[model samples]
Target: MQKTGLLFGSFNPIHIGHLALANYVLEYAPFDEVWFVVSPQNPLKNSEDLAPAQHRLAMTNLAINAEPRFKSSDIEFSMPVPSYTLNTLQRLNELHPTHDFSLIIGSDNLINIDRWHNFRTLLQEHSLLVYPRPEYPIEKAVIALPKSVNVLNAPMLDISSTLIRKGLKEKKNLRFLLPAGVYDYILQHRLYQQKKE
Candidate 1:
């Protein structure tokens, strides 16, 4: 009867903000371990802009190394294209019956849940823990959600992968936003420093 909250994301560089959110869920939410499911491809995101899955996974591992309660998972790497949430959840359910999976998402994402494939089924089958995004209203967002979904007040850091990438492209310093070694890893590999020509 172990409960594990899945924090699914591309984790392009595994920033401090991402680690903070996952750590917050482990402390505040009813979960034993918080797994960062490194999605290979997201339906709403452009894969061309994504770093290689291995690099992203490596950064995630580096970022969560100090936290015993946090883990990095490459579960979605082997999954189908367009990487739908319903598919990933169903696969995880079959593979690990011992661990019950809940979803940790942001309020802004909840606003677009209707666009996700079989999103209602996802809600009925598992728990959803949502944290706030800067401009998204939790009160208004929760109104359309079901009772199983719980809203969390995790600090909404204005950090985003897109912003980080933009900073890199412009040759701006953004080393403080990432985890201890993640910034080093990104520098070593020269990821997202400029858009691929």
Candidate 2:
């Protein structure tokens, strides 16, 4: 059976760090394909500064188009607002019963997983692959997580979408932070450009 790994997140902008992690997972993990499930809205985050769902999805696609193992999914976009991981996983399991589905998350998010909706059910149902986040320790999380969890010691990326957005607002060079096409798209669309007085 084919194994599918879901890398769900509010990829406000698909940065190089995100791509790097996905690539590393694909190479090292048993997963056959890694889907980037672009969340329309994260339950715990403020959406005010978030780029539109379509725009984020488009950027993700552009960034991963060259890779056969990387796929961009808009699964959360079709779902209701404030998409929860449990619901998404349940639905995906039903939709693709033949393939096995596992959840991919960062250590930082795992720290707050207990607060998510039906988080207990989420842990029981799917295998989790948790990668390290900058300034966050995975060992602590590994101790707390159930036997279904796999801790990946992939290269930690200090870059984040928030920092990239801030760089754009400040008119800083974001050449290597994101894909060239994605960077160009942001420039062409004037995304994150602060209004002048």
Model 2: per-residue Cα lDDT over 1-197, one tens digit each:
77888899888888999889988888888679999999999999988778888889999999999999888888777888889889988888888888788888999988878788988888887899999887777755533678888988788889989999999999998979997599998888887788677
* Best-performing candidate as measured by TM-score: 2
Q: Any runs in candidate 2 off by more than 4 Å, and if so which?
A: 195-197
**Candidate 1: regions farther than 4 A off:** 140-143
Pick out the ten consecutive residues of candidate 2 with the lowest summed lDDT. Answer: 135-144
lDDT of 1 at 154: 86
Q: List the residue pairs that clash in candidate 2.
A: none
Residue clash pairs of candidate 1: none
Candidate 1 C-alpha RMSD relative to the actual structure:
1.5
For model 2, the local distance difference test gives 0.86
Tell me the TM-score of model 2: 0.95
Worst 10 residues of 1 by lDDT: 137-146
